[model samples]
Target: MQFSKSLMLLATLATGTFAHPAVGRRQATATSAAVSSDWTATPSSGAYSTAGFGSSTSSSGTGVTYEGNVGNPYGSNIIQISSSDASQYKYVAQFTGANTDSWTVAIFNKYGSDGKMDGWYGQACLTFTLAAGETKYVAFDDDSQGGWAAASGSTIPTDSNGGYASTWGEFDFGSTTNNGWSGFDVSAIAAQNADMTVSGMEICDALGGTCSSISPDAATVNNAYTSAETDVGGIGGNIASGPVRLAVTIDYSG
Candidate 1:
């Protein structure tokens, strides 16, 4: 289902403004750490693999595109990671030719027993067009949280759509009570034969401190995304159902 820009526009009228989610107040002090790495590959029939992670199937869509037949098609299309270690890094995944229907960019995290997202971090989503052989970069930030919150007035459709427009929004994974997370969940159902290819993926440590970057410690991305998806909702929207590929990225601070 296409996003109701009118609805979004109406909501905008309330405050007449759109904004990014607010971050936690506690400013864990630190310096800027660089996280420049790549993990780009086509899934082997719905299976995702990284340097140190397990394999999971997509149920429907493999690699980039999918028929979106099965129920909950976007169940497990992420690189899993284990725990948080000192060497934790950043991760990112880009998509090219994504000028079709709707698309989503999300980051999922599995919290450890300690009540915090063990190795979890943050994620981002962007919309762009390709220029005959040109590619675009869609990245995620593992250094922060609060990207999964829903954008104001925007409702997730339970069906499908043919196109989507560009708009700034936010998402909230349930509430603060739930250890859910925050990340981008972009939906673009615009039908325009375009080729979207994810160029790279990386993971790193947090920016302000030595805290967990992508995850709390050394956790891999595969595990991180899976853990988070367990509670993720409104995936591909109401109209568009089943099997969607969510382009993602991992940020590391080494």
Candidate 2:
């Protein structure tokens, strides 16, 4: 379905980031049921599925678990930390002598007219401060209803659309404060009929813009963040330290 003029305007105003004026139109990829999720770390040992982060070290931990199917073209990319375990695994601290003390975790999807992953169609960045031995949970999701943790003292910020809803099937990590963090819910925008290409996830400074393009044909296991770029969103207020870690999971039906 074509986006209404009002909806497009709302997106332009809400993000303050406009879509590339020259985006080419292309056919959407075929829907698939083959789903998969992967996890990665900067130092290789900072995250664990069980305890999360490092088991021996005192640094904070970060991880991504998948829920839902990408085979459903109109379905939502539901990747988030559980609200039930929000208190146990939301915000995390950086290990001493690690890259940076802060982090910006995000999920990115590419859209192009070439029927391939082109430029970023929708992206969400969750920025947080991490101190040694401190664990905090920050919730985020691609759903329109906002899949964040409200009881965790976090809430999604109101956008130009009035509430925390995704217009162009976008994703969000809520606001950059504790109060904002408490308002997270599992609401995502439906894919509708938009054509999109799934790009792998990445961890970088909280600054906006593109970081690196992960090859979708790689091993599909645990790929490290590489070919980093510094000029993502042009020095933003939400900046993170160096050496950000990101874990990504992609579920698609072949």
Candidate 3:
């Protein structure tokens, strides 16, 4: 379990780019706020701490590592935020087919504006299975931006630099403190760069602002990032500030 996540990539270390997931937007608050509590630890065992990144407390109530954690920080995936607290956050769900297969998924919190674009928090990964018509919703703090990396195997592949090697479901939420604009996109640059299997993925705001997706073959893409689109920026959605509920479809086919 190598804990170093300083990803050195070919894309710009700052600003917006499809090659990496940047230029994040975050929600209704005047400024981005740190979330605290509401998460319950799972049954698995690992060194789980209750810490949050960037002046924010872990909304899930515990800090986690990418691979060594006992289980998902969000626990049951049915979050425990109070109605009052829920007002300040948006939710996203990962949908899958009706099969009982499992996948490795990890969500990393971006280190704000420190460069080293892959500013991943200590660790944030969730591995689970979804039955028919089942999905799990994960909450995102207002004015927060990060990436959710998913792969089809029990173990997620890593890049040459040991970073997650998979298509990223990048998201940015709006708040009063920030620009108050939300955005989401998909990036396959990591997987392609590692020459690994690129899983298909799609992300769309539940309210239908816009969508970003890529096919499994890595040929057909819509508003999503591909290795060929390394130099591109601002390819994903730029939604107005409000309550955002993004739906991310993994192992996408269409």
Ranking by TM-score: 3, 1, 2
Distance from true location, Cα of 164 in model 3, Å: 0.3
- Give the count of colliding residue pairs in each prediction: 87, 46, 16
Model 3: per-residue Cα lDDT over 20-59, one tens digit each: 1122222124222433332222112221222221223222
Top candidate on lDDT is 3
* Ranking according to lDDT, highest score first: 3, 1, 2
Q: Across residues 71-181, which tens digit of lDDT does each residue of candidate 2 receive?
A: 112212223443233322222211111222332222232222222222123223232333322334332221111121111112222334232222122222222111111
What are the per-model C-alpha RMSD values against the true structure?
19.6, 19.7, 11.2
For model 1, the superposed segments whose C-alpha errors exceed 4 Å read: 1-34, 39-93, 98-128, 138-178, 182-254
Worst 10-residue lDDT window for candidate 3 reads: 60-69
Higher-TM-score candidate among 1 and 2? 1
Measured with C-alpha atoms, the lDDT of residue 131 in candidate 3 is 46
Question: Which should have the higher TM-score, number 2 or number 3?
Answer: 3
lDDT of 1: 0.23
Q: Candidate 2: list runs displaced more than 4 Å.
A: 1-75, 83-100, 110-116, 119-122, 125-254
* Better candidate by TM-score, 1 or 3: 3
